[model samples]
Target: MSANKTAMGDIASSTETYPFEKDERYRSQQGLNGFAVKEPFLPNGLGLQVRKRKMVRKRKNVDESPFSVLCAWVVEHQIGLSLNLLLLLSLTHFFFSRARPYTSLFLGMSYYNPKSKKYTQGWEDMYFVATWIIIITGLRVAVMDYILKPIARYGGVNKPKAQVRFAEQGWLFCYYSLFSPLGMYIIYQTKYWFNLREIWTDFPTHTMNGLLKWYYLVQFAFWLQQIFVVNIEEKRKDYWQMFSHHIFTSALMFSSYGYYQTKVGVVILAIMDVVDLLLPLAKMLKYMNFRTACDITFGVFIAVWFVARHVIYMMVCWSMFSEIPHVMKQGCYNSTTGQMISEDGGTAVWWNVMQPFDRPGGTICYNNNIRIAFTALLMALQVLTLIWFGMILRVAYGVLSGKGAEDSRSDDEGEDEEYEEIEYYDDKIKSFDGTNEIVTRTIALPIEEDVNAEEMNLGLRRKSTSPTTASAPRRSTRRTGSARATALSIPGHSDKKDILGRIGCDKPS
Candidate 1:
């Protein structure tokens, strides 16, 4: 009895502090320490699954229902880009020449350029290429390996393939690329028989310039239309969102650009080349993890663009600035046979693309050193902006939509992250219960202290000096103590109880 009073005094005097575990019933309410969360002890007739069945919803607040315009822009961008890569590659052969010592080569034969005094060699066999191989082969693994594949499988990348009824049309991409630079060009001196300077750069050329300027304007206008709708509809997937998709397509285009430039890493970004070849088929087979596939595709796209650009810029200095002439020995008068060879200039795409511009002006600027085209410069600038703007817009949308982080749903859905189903158990799943008297919605959940849940559970099992048990037993123990004293004195108190006539249950007043 003395010990009990001492313990009680200690807990009471320490009023300055209340140990976090002050009650057991409250703990039980949350479910006994932690073996599992207590579902309400449900009676047979009631369960939650019957109550909260899944709901399907259509998107609301989407402002731009005119999807036709967006689709049209997408088609135009793709077609224009494909033509730029295919036409130029088919007509350009400067990269295959081994006479150019810096170029990568696996196999080829030599050809004498009488116009240029040196013997030029060709290297066309592609063997053991490194970076391009990784980009290509890694496509499958990126989509299927680790966590990414699971996430992708959760997405709708798995769908049925429709049969193709017709054969593909040929663009002569491979042939023109191999033969054009080899001096096998069938038309005028080079593939660009329509050089504006040859026809005078004043009227029609100026008109071409206006058309190109309009393409840029229309491209950005589509982006603006998409972003505006995203702002109102609170959707994460919008036209602004679609620009990020360009990372893949642009990478492919630039690889062809690198090939046109004849850089050492011509094949570096080629992973998607094969991806381009096989992704449609893979999607048809339902053999793709969509999230991982897009991610892999995006990563390789970005890497190849940056690395290929890096290699091209670094290699361009030597390949173009070196002073070896095609055939100076033939002399200027005799050299009037084929494309004009100037001894002072370097060889490569830097010359091929820009030579026309310089000849018209009768002056070339070497001040920039590498002689990079203003057009290529503009492209590099835009690519950087594209990446930067995409990231910025994501953060903007998240902040604007009040979703602190961006989550992807269907392309039609806004930027909200799809909520995953909360799992309880796998084998013989124990259903969730709201009325079982333990768990409830968070609005009704009682607040608790931050003690480690594991440590708290350990204390419950040991029961020795458990703070929860100590504080909770006061009333029950007091009732037990008083009951014992009353039983001991009951015989002596009988007269007192009879006088009051209220002590014994069998006695009636």
Candidate 2:
């Protein structure tokens, strides 16, 4: 009895001086401890799969459903999955590419072919391009994870969570670095740069070349992959918003492709992607602990984002709105060379559809409803882009003010540590008898904390501490002298019986 009392006294003394455990929990909750949050305890009804069935024996091997377990695993190991998917798809891509050698995947590929301007796409060609995207993206993820991360670690990049993020951003940097430039190059290859009127002037009869077709296809696949990547990986605060953005963007690409608007599509894509390259790079640098580099890059990214997404994108939208109405009313542009066709009636749909403005009677015909819908969707995209930019500005303000924090808006949601389920052994407390029996508390820490305190702490929030009040048992340990004695005697005292009496429970006589 004396030895146990002495041990309790020692613990009480230590608690009085410095409660390191409590401080650690507080630091982690503030994101200063670099730990994950605790997983929540399963509700009591969780044991009952259905409402009225006999409670089945809980499975020991796997506590969670397969789907949930799979989802959690995928969220933790996105890079590995991306790499695996890339490698597996690459093999399929190789075989398909060989099978469909010299084939064009786009329906508009024949537009530039003067002899036979008939749109065609073999399934093999489509599959090949898809596999190609998966492979390239996979390779990007793998290279960043395996190669770039190791190199960063060698250079003293110690933050594992940051390292994971660095790898994530690395792939984005690579993707935009390669494809954004290619998209621009494709645009430059066209007459759209010199003659903005050419875009809308072609109208419904416009077509895509092999290069333009492939660019749109690649972008479609890229964004599609992003949808999967973002969902399967740790979700951010803006998960649904970003998810919606991907959906809208992907829809735009598809709609534009269907409507044969690759010229404008490529231009918009190039503008958006070129600026996007900087953001991921900046984030990567920040994760690598290169604050100066990150700040510079981020500043540049902000400038570029404003210019590209706002100034230039809005300009393109305005041009489309003003010019397409005029061009559609006038029968304009030739098939082979894209030269202006006279008002007499050219084969291009712009001329053939209706000469509303240039009619003999001067009756102007408005464009079909499809054109209206496309423009509306594009306008909606602009609005969404504006909303996202506002979030970026907030993050930028934090960075510029020397906060040294990542965008709180985009921090991955599940990055914080989760506490493990609270497990109880039947023998620990025996039972609650509603008597003067002393409660012997057994605090069960999370299994994950037991395995690796640091590993589970990666980017996770700290567990909340028990409340400090007389009613709270957590505070009982802090009491000293008479206060401690009083707390210990409360269970047996009639006045303090109010604690159990409040719940309509009475002491066993």
Top-lDDT structure, candidate number: 2
Runs of candidate 2 with Cα error greater than 4 angstroms are 1-63, 68-125, 330-368, 398-407, 412-414, 420-509
lDDT of 1 by residue, 73-131 (tens): 54335434434543443344365454334332311212334554333111221221221
Model 2 earns a TM-score of 0.59
lDDT of 2 by residue, 411-441 (tens): 3344443333322111111111223333333
In order of appearance, the predictions have TM-scores of: 0.25, 0.59
Steric overlap count per candidate: 17, 19
Each prediction's RMSD to truth = 27.0, 17.6
Candidate-wise lDDT, in order: 0.27, 0.51
